[model samples]
Target: MTEQHGSDTGPRYAARRRRGGIVSFVVGLVATLAFFAFFPGMPHVIDWGAVLASLAVGALARAGCRAWMAKEAEKEGKRIGHF
Candidate 1:
């Protein structure tokens, strides 16, 4: 069933945005760090390219997740006659 809410941007919206930002940035940073960790022979210098790619990928993933969730919610809303 669709969730019952007074508005789309409810009290949790800010929290969710903050969390998502932190998560995405952390995931990006960790991904690059992990790659460097695996290659001991390589220079310790961080790969800015990989780090950027990680952030881009994380953003894409978040967008994909949001799209899927939105579709599901739309379906549920329609089913429940809420929209």
Candidate 2:
């Protein structure tokens, strides 16, 4: 029931890179700032919808990158990291 990977080093050496909380926080901060900076019109009260949407977009972008990397790795007979 074991899954086989193409590399001779095997899964043991196919270590996943860990993305820290700080990185995620920084990304979110930059994205939010950029959105507000370009779009303008920030309300006195926090706009939950805009905040959520920005975060969702960032998350989707990250997911898409990982998926693309995974696909590329598959083609190259290699495993992609989780991060």
Candidate 3:
């Protein structure tokens, strides 16, 4: 006897996750850049390497936020094709 499986949700979930990740990254990057640009004291407080490191950290944070949001969306059955 053959066992039938239901719909495969992985691709849909991943697509949504990727889209959310990109949006989050863009927003976070912009905010970070603006903050650095507008805060006069910030330049003196951080070196070039530190600034680069912070940017990397911000990227990771954005990715994490996106992943969390995607997971939450998946839990709520918010798959891309569903809506």
* TM per prediction: 0.49, 0.52, 0.53
Please give the distance, in angstroms, between residue 51's alpha carbon in candidate 1 and its true position after superposition.
0.9
- Pick the lDDT winner: 3
Tens digits of per-residue lDDT for model 3 on 1-83? 53223243457555656777677776766666666667876664545665675577668867687767756766766543322
lDDT of 3: 0.62
Evaluate model 2: give its lDDT. 0.56
Clashing pairs in 3: none
lDDT of 1 at 69: 46
Residue 63 CA displacement from its true place in model 1, Å: 0.4
- The residue-by-residue lDDT of candidate 2 on 14-61, one tens digit each, is 432124233554576568757765665655443677677667766665
Off by over 4 Å in 1: 1-45, 78-83
User: Which candidate, 2 or 3, would have the higher TM-score against the true structure?
Assistant: 3
Worst 10 residues of 2 by lDDT: 13-22
- Candidate 3 segments whose C-alpha is farther than 4 A from its true place: 1-8, 40-54, 77-83
Clashing pairs in 1: none
